[model samples]
Target: MKDLKEQKTEPVQMARSDLLLSLVKASVSGDKNAVRTAVEGIIADEKGKQHRVLAERLTRALHTNGNGTRAMNQMAHDTGIRGREFLAELTPRHQLSDMVLADQTRKTVDQLIEEQQRASLLRSHGLDPRHRIMLVGPPGNGKTSLAEAIAEALAVPFFVIRYEALIGSYLGETANRLKRVFDYVRTTPCVVFFDEFDAVGKERGDTHETGEIKRVVSSLLMHVDELPSYAVIIAASNHAELLDRAVWRRFQLRLPLPAPTEKELAVFFDRHIQNFDGKPGIAPATLAKRLGPISYAEAEEFILDVRRREVLSMLETPLKTIFADQIKAWEDRAKPMGQEESAR
Candidate 1:
């Protein structure tokens, strides 16, 4: 007994001028590519609404623009080379101020930031900014954070290279995907971070490695060389010794982030713990001394654990008691580096 009107599909939510604002922005930007992309998006949207006549008209209009049809045809052919296939866009949340660095590291990072901010001035005098960086460090340090912060500092798009999506089972697949990655980033300025870079950039001369590894390394370095100055590549590797000899030459700056000292860890912990509403009962330095050697990541994680436990306690446990118990528990679980190696 339903009415005939009820049998109809729900109205297209965006049928009434929702895409017009995008069209306006694209038109004002004077970027033909952006305008074309916006128009095509509208066409697709309209087609989904069963507005076949209107969609056909929009398509005809788009085709009239110089090279639009040809460009779209090319796009259709290379539809597999999508940014999402090998890249993940990240929100640039961290800034240089958000991290604590050694004196030398801070100075170098500051210089790079200055150079990038004044890239136009440098280019006018026949200079290119230093954009190729190799971050060598132990795991659990601030390598990834540093890359993200640099992108934030420069107000650029931050993209992390997804090895999971990029690596293929077929021969020559990985290199092709890497090339596609470089091809997409070249069109615009961005921070392209290759974390755990040694996975593909291993030493070519290492006979223990496969021929495919050699090929991937070669392709990776080639793309690195070809990328424009505007496209910053920040490659981080824990096993720096495993990277190719040629790979070492490709980077403009090779920075190291070593394991933190007790004082340094304490300082880092203090900065983080102050952010929590339930402050630590003991001083960060005292707590850090109790925890022994640890990475910046571990310090942050410890703070999180303390905060979580404190919040869940619902005011039953004193913050000081909770803080002391956490320190003891964490220390008990963490083995000495030598003991871990021996056990292995």
Candidate 2:
């Protein structure tokens, strides 16, 4: 019996080792199909060892079926982008009315949504709906939100490119990863968003930049040019000045979302506070005056902080007290650079 068990385990051990080797190779080479095959092989090996429950558990976690990424998205099974970690695919829920925007920006978004809705009609007229979009703004000023809103308005899948995973240091690696992203999105009608786009789209003319960046930019622009209007590409940059000159021309719409003025902040404040169970005791205009110009993200954070204090206090503290206490802390945190600590 001991001899029989050892002989039986010998083949299983050998198969396990081979499968693990394949897994390592597939992972290092970034081969998704090979990884799947290796994992399935391992699962079979586990089953051969009479570890049926463990094998079934491992098989369940492997997400071998087409429904792993997006259960309802038929495109997941149809494309090679399945299981890609660098692309976060989502069904956007934000509407245009969810956030405040400048009048012109809002109108342009509305127009784009309308154009996309009537895209077939436009195609019949031998025209493609405008799809390439560039959003320029400071951090936390609704650039990302606006992209999501557009995708939501169009009722399309929203794909956010994860730069951390997409940017590889190896020669030609980054461009290749970017190409895969564009190819994947092109297979289906979806909204692809590249946030912090200046990271890849930086000016090729910059004295400090390397040839690698220039080549990457060239590759990116080529992909953008070839992308069909059916797949919308939205890229947001904090430093529009840093983007390649060619990148600007590639985008059909380059929208600027600057920091909100005091008045605009007040309007945003009024709209934002309406959702709260209790309104802020301080008026929007007065709060804006005291807060100075800040990103909508900061404004929202301040509001939430005040609400947190209010909630923790069990509504014992007045809204006025909460606002007065939090505003000083908010100012200290948000003060302009080069301002002295004492002055702050």
> What are the lDDT figures for the candidates, one per model?
0.80, 0.79
Candidate 2 residue 23 C-alpha distance from true site, Å: 40
Q: Which residue pairs overlap in candidate 1's backbone? A: none
TM-score of predicted model 1?
0.75
Error of 2 at 189 (Å): 1.5
TM-score to true structure, per model: 0.75, 0.72
Over 4 Å off in model 1, which ranges?
1-81, 335-344
How far residue 302's Cα lies from its native spot in candidate 1, in Å, is: 0.4
lDDT of 1 by residue, 245-297 (tens): 99999998999989888888888888877776665688888988999888988
